[model samples]
Target: MNRYPTVLTIAGSDSGGGAGIQADLKTIAALGAYGTSAITALTAQNTQGVRAIHPVPPAFLQEQLEAVFEDITVDAVKIGMVNTVEVARVIADMLDRFKPGFVVFDPVMVSTSGSKLIQDETVAVLWQELFPRVDLITPNLDEAEILIGGQIRTPATMKGAAIQMVEKGCRAVLLKGGHLVGSTIYDVLAQSSQEPLILESDYIESRNVHGTGCTLSSAIATYVARGNSLAESIIFAKEYIAGAIRSGADVVTGYGPGPLNHSFSPVSMQIVS
Candidate 1:
């Protein structure tokens, strides 16, 4: 039997539906892939910020993973918002067990509203156990700063930090530069023994920036799941995100930041050999 390229998102459920697993699934589908999810936590969150979080138990989380891996051909996996290090450990163990072909770990450390999402110990396990196990790790400026133990205040520092994350076990790192104050946003993709890829784009003046990171990584996973090379995946995902941002720049969803136009133009599942 034939199948669509499948990508699974292991993440928190966003009640607002603009970010987290919601955004991940939307991004995956929009990018022409079948989307599945194993929700890690429940969040009382909206565009303004995250209010509360309830983590899924480790055993239950494992069951969700098993449910998907047993039946689905997960071509790629996107992981987000695992609150506890134990949960991360469980996810890592399961990944080792199933050997998912491609994995994108989005280290969602803090919310846009300044909420701390991960603890120190959790960070330790995430970096030591999970980062090395995945194909790529996508961290925004703040997350990269935390992971690399330095300031990523400039584009040069951001590239340096991406390389540092590689040294800390990431097979590849996409150190997002959206947080920096600039006219052109430079997202650095650092791979082991490869030249750092500098993805530059003019900043789209849009406050509807919720779930941007989640969407980007999910799109990458989707393209990778569709048999695209990692570099091609990154490039395609970036273009997809830019379109999403531009399409939704003026649309109002909530009182604060709005969701991206993931369905700006629906495309059928892309099957590549």
Candidate 2:
């Protein structure tokens, strides 16, 4: 029997359609997977900045999760921007209950402007209840610093932070070095049992990178859902996002940082047995 390799994105909603649930769904679909969602919050924002956020109640979030998992065979899961501790707990419970095949968590703790998004309590809950359950935790430099309480200034420091996060309970860590200074970017992938793998790319100088993190993580889940190994999935996701960025670099969507061209070269929906 064949069915679409389904990926469920549990995250917030971005009215800008560049990040959170919007980006996740777009990335998943672009990578040839069936996309499902369980929205955790709603944000009013554009390429410039976020103005407000409306969180979904924890119970309602649980209902959303159940509605999808009860019927669909979610081949993978991508989690982003869980603002409240209660919402984090609800998502943690669902993951425990469903035990999905693959879980990629993008710890969206800091904003583009360097403001903290999740509370300290919510961060604690993520570490205690969710980190162990996720297969990979993708944290940009800012989020990684918050998680580990240190600075990541170079690829070497990024490696150290990724290892520290793995030691703190994460099954694996992908510490993004996009925020680091340079034309070349480094993303370090680390686990307790294996040496860290440093993935590098020539950073594209573009303001249209509002949803790169969300897109990368969701693409990772989509590839894994399509039967790629975790390492292979990360590599493929890196290539996909690069193309998306380059494809949309010149197109202006808003006054500030625009979004990637997610459908630059989308694949057909993939089938798996």
Candidate 3:
């Protein structure tokens, strides 16, 4: 029997099941990887907005990480929504210790409703410690603006921000341009020593895009686990997310924004012979 490549997600839990660990796991499974999780926090959230948030203890978080790392063969990791500086630090420490093969950091500092998820103090910790440890960091335009302490309004600015993130020790940066106002959505993937690649998609007009960032990052991590190159991973992940968005557009899950169709089809895990 062949063992499937395993992907782990360390993220907050979204009660609505649209974003956070729920979305990450869904995307991972949909992309044909075994999904595991170490939840950082729990939020009372829905399509409308976040109602309340309760962070898990750092010690418990560590335990979760250790438990998963000790037993499961984690092929890749997708980290999201470390809500505090200590949580971020803990995750960074674990990453340093274990050094998972492929790590995707979805720097989830804000919600789709434009509310801050992580605190200001944690931002420095994330930049100093967590930023350098991961294989790829996926930050949307708003999160990128917060990271670089400046505005990112254009494609040039996005590329500059990605380069700045690369300089900050991130191996590569996938700066998402979904929030930008336009018909064409451009996602810039910039590596440390390579020429940056631009992935432009015809913007799918839809309201059901709540968990796009989480889904995209998780899908990319799954591809990486399955032995795809970073560029190839991003390309395939982009196509998958586009299809998800297109498929889930008319399905109403909530009064506000809904989630993408992560499991439109059961994608079999691709194992190298």
Per-prediction TM-score, please? 0.97, 0.98, 0.97
User: TM-score rank, highest first?
Assistant: 2, 1, 3
Which of the two candidates, 1 or 2, achieves a greater TM-score against the reference? 2
For candidate 2, lDDT tens digit of each residue in 215-242?
A: 9999999999999999999999999999
Residue-by-residue lDDT tens digits, candidate 1, 1-273: 577899999998999999899999888888788999999999999888888999989999999999999998899999999889889999999999999999999999898778888878898898788998999999998888788778878888888888888887889998889988888999999999998888898888899888999999999999999889999999998888889999999999988888889888767987644
On the 0 to 100 scale, the lDDT of residue 232 in model 3 is: 88
Output the worst ten-in-a-row residue range by lDDT, candidate 3.
264-273
- Stretches of candidate 1 off by over 4 Å are 271-273
Best by TM-score: 2
lDDT of each: 0.90, 0.91, 0.91
Off by over 4 Å in 3: 269-273
- Better TM-score candidate (2, 3): 2
